[model samples]
Target: MLNYKTLLFSLGIAVALFSCKNQETEKKTETKRPNIVFMMSDDHAYQAISAYNDKLINTPNIDRLAQEGALFNNASVTNSICAPSRAVILTGKHSHLNGKIDNLSKFDTTNVTFPQILQDAGYQTAMFGKLHFGNNPKGFDEFKILPGQGSYYNPRFITKDGDTVIDGYVTDIITDLTIHWLEKERDKEKPFLLMYLHKAPHRAWLPAERHYKEFTKKEFPLPETLFDDYTRIHPEDLEASSPDAASKKYNLDQPKSRKSTAAKTAEMNILTHMVLTNDNKLKDSTVKKLGIKERYLGDPTNRMSKEQKAAWDKVYDPINKEFEEKYPEMDDKDLMKWKYQRYMQDYLGTIASVDENVGRVLDYLDDNNLSENTIVVYTSDQGFYLGEHGWFDKRFMYEESFRTPLLIKWPNRIEAGITKEEMVQNLDFAQTFLDAAGVNAPDEMQGESLLPLLKGEKDAWDRDAVYYHYYEYPAEHAVKRHYGIATKEYKIMHFYYDVDEWELYDRKNDPQELHNVFYDPDYAEVREMMIKKLEETRKKYKDSEELDKQFIKVYNDK
Candidate 1:
């Protein structure tokens, strides 16, 4: 029998042991959730980033994410259009399911987004820069979005308070707002989802004052397929009928045999349709002498202030004069070279600003001690054509336009300098973010979480192929509607609506995608296998002829 003192002492010791054990258990279970900083640029190409290919441009800041974390070699999008691609990212579903099939279609508000789920799970959410569609973005605690294809100079931002036009380069302004939110507005206690998007490198590529001077002086190497003739279009077909005649033949109920008009129908050839004054920044008088008319839109410089206009003239005036002097001697080939150079100068210049601003955000994270617990992701809305296939826009299932750049860094979690070849899409971003935070993704979400792949768990991922669709046709650029499945070795696309064509590519043999091997007898076995895969993928995704007809009806009505 113990005395009173001994019994009390024993009781106290037991209580202390129990309390310590409980605390240890709590500590083990309560893992700190990671903050996500998602940075996306508009129309940024993988080829432009030096991490993927150093031949095109040197993007040291963007490459920093790739060096410090994992670079996805096979990251792509479901759809290649801007607004539709964005909708897919937000909803984690394909365009057909999300009801944002094309840029003209309104976004379905009833659908749940990952940001909404994150916000519900006690994560602080914010979005800055172009949403590209809706003004009032759901699930964000704070947002300042660009009003539908915002300008490069003196861009107007729509905010919760009201619309405010900030007077600076749009790229710098967007970065400034993002950093400001990080430093001032972000809640310290909770995890955050920050979307810092850029409007630069979109349409009418306008660079900041600092970049245009040097970029204009430097000439970039032309793409090998810059002067690509439409080899898919036959000689007789070229003289058969125009796009207008083909549109009339396309029946609403039952489509006609449009054949393989995919290559020739589009008006995206950089030499002809890319207007001199709208895209290339030629002086109005110089364009008049060259027999060029402003076809795309009015001069992009018309929105500039006096000082901005003066600075633009200071750089472009000399280039215009040189072009005018060379116009007499310039042939079609010479003109193509000149136009390609001009396009690259302005396009790449915008990217330089994006790279600089990305460095700013990365440094802020490092300086603030947020690097260890934060997940930083970098990507684009979708890949752009940097003169690949003799085109300047994205509306195709081709490799250059289909593939987007994806880099993710999470200190002490993801191993540095890793490259993943698994086929991941923007569709996976939602579930990945939710999974990283220990939140359950909604059942309606269709994307697989990339958390395992990000953490270097290669065997945990088993996806061998990805799906792609493009649905903006008889519209700008005139890219025919198509959807396909892409494995590492092969790709098959079916162009429909105005044309019914099944095109296949042997990716391993022809990396440039210069040849279509659909009708080749040698590839019959491969074609049969790919066709079965395509049908299975389409069915797995719940896309059917009914959905196709429904979307076509909506488009025709519009």
Candidate 2:
């Protein structure tokens, strides 16, 4: 009905309107997202980090994370094991819900993850280092992960297309690969989510050549319970004249006693932190000689090149010679002490490299002008026992292993130099990442978004406590199945596998968790209250004896 001139004019107005709408949508998308770098280390203990406790060792690089932003004073893991912790972080769900309660359980990648949410929301995602999940990772634009436990020296990494062995330390190599992706492969147009993981400071601690000799001579002060004789040593045995030399030699008593059947079964101790050929940097011949007495444990020299072995020999041969001369004559208690020192040295040495590499990543973000908009986080899978209770591994509900170091820096949104004492779990990680990208987390996700807490909304929300469950029973370390709830004031736990026992600790009076007052008459009222809370928490998480019974067959197979 209209003339040709009128029709052309109408078409022109419609084109202009559509362009403006599209531009606004693009701007909105850009404004909502922030780049994220999640830097995690395997088995790095909170006590070992200088930021949490400065008495043990210096960690200037990790301390920078705490200094620059918020440090979580009460960060914890639901499950203290490796792969289970990672699974909880990814899915924002508990172990039972996520179906990865223990290392033996597979991480079902089909479940929705925060990375998938971000990826769908137009964020470019990259993961480097130990993904730990056996299968190839999903929801990432690109990934290069270590195979199995991955090696310490010249580790092999599995990439999208294929696998290649990179010649360098694992921590250093991970950082190198991360920077490479940031510099070359990343899409400049999209915001990124990069998960940088480290394999050092895990089991069979192995340090790189640079840090091999570090902390070798320094004898770290032992934990008060490093020689916890379990009160088996009577007062008479403590006498100087006693024939029980081990009991008399190190006369010490735990402040308050809270013995459990599980504690009696614990097998992971500093003495159990055995040195190996590659772990101790010993020559194959030296390890064999130590094995003659059937005292030395673990496998032979790890896979390494001739040049690599020679370099290791240069550093450790002298130490091995000294140890070989002294160890046989030493008493059992003294031998345990010596082994503890060796374990700590190598463990701390590996951490030194991790810290140095952390500095590299921090530098990268700062140098590239990414610091302003990017969120930087440093944490570990869970806490490890640094000779606490004479132990070296994690998986205890004890504070030494329950608490982990968490430092997060978001320059634009979060103020620097803040510490939050609220109890936050790794389960909250997925929701937080989703919140950062302005993406809504699914209702199925169990963890509440930690964004409010991290943003200094101290009173914005209230979660009175956190729940924990561990189920790798009849497995390694002989740690029984346990579940508990930790409020700010108290922690109540029940170890139900192989034995039934309850342990309750008053956090204020005994922060070290040295004693359990589960049966004390003074705590009768509190016990009732905590038990009710524990029941509620269990119900909230959908974890109970019935659930375990349903899944018991799975773990039983092994």
Give each model's clash number: 0, 0
TM-score of candidate 1 to 2 decimals: 0.91
* TM agreement with the true structure for every prediction: 0.91, 0.88
- lDDT, residue 97, model 1: 91
- lDDT tens digits, residues 434-483, model 1? 99999988887889998887776748888888998888877989899999
The root-mean-square deviation over C-alpha atoms between each candidate and the true structure, in angstroms, is 5.8, 8.3
For model 2, what is the alpha-carbon lDDT of residue 71?
A: 95
For candidate 2, which ten residues in a row score worst on lDDT? 237-246
List of clashing residue pairs for candidate 2: none
Cα lDDT tens digits for candidate 2, 405-485: 899998857888898888899998898889888899999899988788778775865988999988888887888889999
In TM-score terms, candidate 2 sits at 0.88
- Among residues 3 or more apart in sequence or in different chains, the pairs in candidate 1 whose N, CA or C atoms overlap within 3 Å are none
